[model samples]
Target: MMDENDVKELISSYKNIKDRVEIISNKFDRHNVKLVAVSKTKPTEMIRILYDKGHRHFGENYIQELVSKSEELSELNEIKWHFIGSIQSNKSKILTSVKNLYVVETVENKKILDKLAKSLLNNEENNNNNNNNNNKKLNIMIQVNTSGEESKSGCKPEECLDLVKHCLEDNNCKNSLNFLGLMTIGNPNATPDQPDFKCLVDCKNNISKQLNIPLDSIELSMGMSHDFEPAIEFGSTSVRVGSAIFGERDYSNKK
Candidate 1:
């Protein structure tokens, strides 16, 4: 549904947002940190244009939206998709079924991990490619409830270690999932120094020391459309940026 002019506009928009994020990240020399453009409700036309402009990483919050986009845009070979949303138990299989899904940024407990692990294994089995685990592994991040907000879905800080250990102990999960590090959402109305973002950084440090995993090897996925700059300042290795790049979502005429 997009013309060439619309494609150029989207590319221009993506460059502007990415430049701003880079300006902030450069202050701390976070050259390798990623900007996962959250494109949940955005259409394939917009996403494809950005993909054409060399923005490889894109994120989505809902499984159906993600699957639809991936299916529609299957012609693009190098698009890296991120599931930057809350994973529903009933839709775990569908979420993992996305062909280009690069990271699952909402692993809060062993149950979701167990379900995804089973799904990943089954998928590999069905493909008759069980011998090669490298191609089937899914990257996952443990989300921490730093703010203790009742509305947020994540594991409490106190319970994070136990959950991480459980995920590591399950051979299938450990094999099927590449435990990246941690992720947390910030309150939009809050200031740049969001305590929740800091909590995620600290949690990752503690996990690295406790589990003997290299601190650099573990990444922190924090921040969003509103607070990504602060998240980068707080040692966030990756940010889930959405509206800032895609513009505001229109929730009209829906259930």
Candidate 2:
């Protein structure tokens, strides 16, 4: 249960985050962008308050935390869980099994794709037998390394088109994985028109044209606490902001 102080803080954080998103978004044509409250590392009590306050979308970076939280918050059927971290082959099945998993935003290569394919294939069979057509397919986003950062887990900008093509058309896994659009962690210091964000915009256009997919139908998932405003200006459909909404993370126990 949240104490008075905790409740106040959560309310303040949610309002600030919402206001910023609206203020920035009003300047753009596409103001329908989503605000993903990144609740990774934060406790469910805190997340619950935000959920109670009407923020249904939450993002998690780790598998264990996401699964456990989803189960814990099972009563709130409206919560949308987003897996925003690197995909591990070992954890693919667990990911596929997550209920209310609205989107996976970090698909980078063929190996992870193959593992996910197996899990999704199993899901298809199970759903087919059960006549559960509503949950047959899953939404997927290609994570492109627009910043060209070596440490980041994303496909290189040049490699993104083929990865997209593989997911959208050529791959056998398209039935289960609906390749929606693209995502990128733009360079923190770069301007909206610069390297990272620009690459994402350009890459999406090229790929959509190449695949004959309507460019407008593709969603761009970019921006975070420090850079969402510019990301909105650059056509980001959703911004993942954690610290700004959940306060600074408690990293004392983190490795």
Candidate 3:
């Protein structure tokens, strides 16, 4: 329902945020920090506008909405959809069925991980049967509840290592799921020196050493529209931003 003026504003806002992220990344000597434009309630036309402008990475927080958008935008071959919301156990099959689903950034337990891996295997087999042989493994990140908030959907900081080990070593998961990194939703009121961010950073470092992988290999997906600048400085490789780029969401109509 965005008019031409709304479209213009969206693009301008997106570009401004993108440029700011790049500037902060450059200032801190961090390169390749991905800006996942969080498009949960936004319309596909707005997404397509950004897509046409060469912004391929988009994130959705709800499974049904994500599936719809992925299908609607299926023609855009290079689109990378990041699912940043909580994963329900029964929804794994429907979620993995989504085409161009680049990563699921809210994996917190072995159950969800196993289900996703199985779904990915089935999807790959289906693709092979159809002579479509691009068998790319889906990327997954462990969500660490660094702030210890009961409302957040992530594993405790201490539990992350074991979960990550299971992800890397389990036969079902290793084959279809790529252990990309750790993700977190920190305390909303915390400042730049938020201990939640530091806790997540520690989780990444511990996982890297315990698993014998390089530090850079484990991406930290922290930060949002509010504190992305500090997040980049705190070694966040991927930031999920929503309202800053798309304007405030009108959640009234959402069920």
Best by lDDT: 3
223, model 2: CA deviation in Å? 0.5
Task: Tell me how far candidate 2 lies from the true structure as C-alpha RMSD in angstroms.
Answer: 1.8
Question: How accurate locally, in lDDT, is each candidate?
Answer: 0.83, 0.86, 0.92
Taking all chains together, each candidate's TM-score versus the true structure is 0.92, 0.94, 0.97
Where does candidate 2 stray beyond 4 Å? 127-134, 252-255
Error of 1 at 15 (Å): 1.1
Alpha-carbon shift of residue 33 in model 1 (angstroms): 1.4
> What's the TM for model 1?
0.92
Q: What's the lDDT for candidate 2?
A: 0.86
Q: Encode model 2's per-residue lDDT on 1-255: one tens digit a residue.
A: 768987898889889889988988887766689999998888889888988888999999988888998989889899999899888889999999998999999999977777787798888788879988765678889899998879898998899888877776645578778887899998887864667887899998998888888988899999999998888888899999999888899866431
Off by over 4 Å in 3: none
Question: Which model, 2 or 3, shows the larger TM-score?
Answer: 3
Q: How much is 249 displaced in model 1, in angstroms? A: 0.7
Error of 1 at 68 (Å): 0.9
Candidate 3 local Cα displacement, residue 171, angstroms? 0.6
- Which candidate number would show the highest TM-score if scored against the true structure? 3
Instruction: Give the worst 10-residue stretch by lDDT in candidate 3.
Output: 246-255
